[model samples]
Target: MSEQNKTWCPNIEFNETDEELILKAELPGVKIEDLIINAQTRFVSISGICNPDKSTDEKEVIPSQFNYGQIKCNTPLPVAIQPEKTRAEFIDGVLTISMPKLRVASAVNF
Candidate 1:
């Protein structure tokens, strides 16, 4: 397939703390403005576009293994989360998402 028609899925890592769940995705060559992130109580979806190298002419370019095209990833969260409180950050080609876990109140006996 052509570079622009290819689809790539970024590598993702998941971690959890006592109060929150963390998701990290490696998205090299993807710009912040091109990213789209959405989270629900049990799932998170990420999509973006990575533009192909434009500085070099097609005739002068060497065959490369780099991926450039549409990026997509849809993963289920390990635990229930507070979707309204989810936070995300992108830095150094990495995207980090912090989701606070849903807390259930225990029954109290009088």
Candidate 2:
């Protein structure tokens, strides 16, 4: 199939703590340079491209279920976050993003 015609979705997990929110995405065979991440106060978006291995050999056709090409995911945060403080890392085909929650002061009555 043509590279432009293929599309795939990566598995993702989102979690939140009292101090921060965490997002994890499983992307096999995807390079770090091909990833793009955008974070806002209330949402996060991830996009990337995964290319299939190129081979120049004559072989018989076989049935396979591997996905390639563009991938995109947009998820809303459970709470307000500090997008400026967001941090991310990619390891072993897995991406982990950590975002600190925006702290709001509580009202006090004397």
Which candidate ranks first by TM-score, i.e. highest?
Answer: 1
Report every candidate's CA lDDT.
0.91, 0.87
Error of 1 at 73 (Å): 0.7
Candidate 2 local lDDT, 4-110, one digit each (tens): 55766688888888898999999878899999999999999988898777576845277446667888888888898999999999999999999999999999999
- Provide the clash count, candidate 1: 0
Error of model 2, residue 86, in angstroms:
0.3
Candidate 1 regions with alpha-carbon error over 4 angstroms: 58-62
Model 2 worst lDDT run, 10 consecutive residues = 58-67
TM-score, model 1 to reference:
0.89
What lDDT tens digits, residue by residue, belong to model 1 across residues 1-110?
88878988899999999999999999988899999999999999999899876666566357667778898889999899999999999999999999999998999999
Off by over 4 Å in 2: 1-4, 58-60
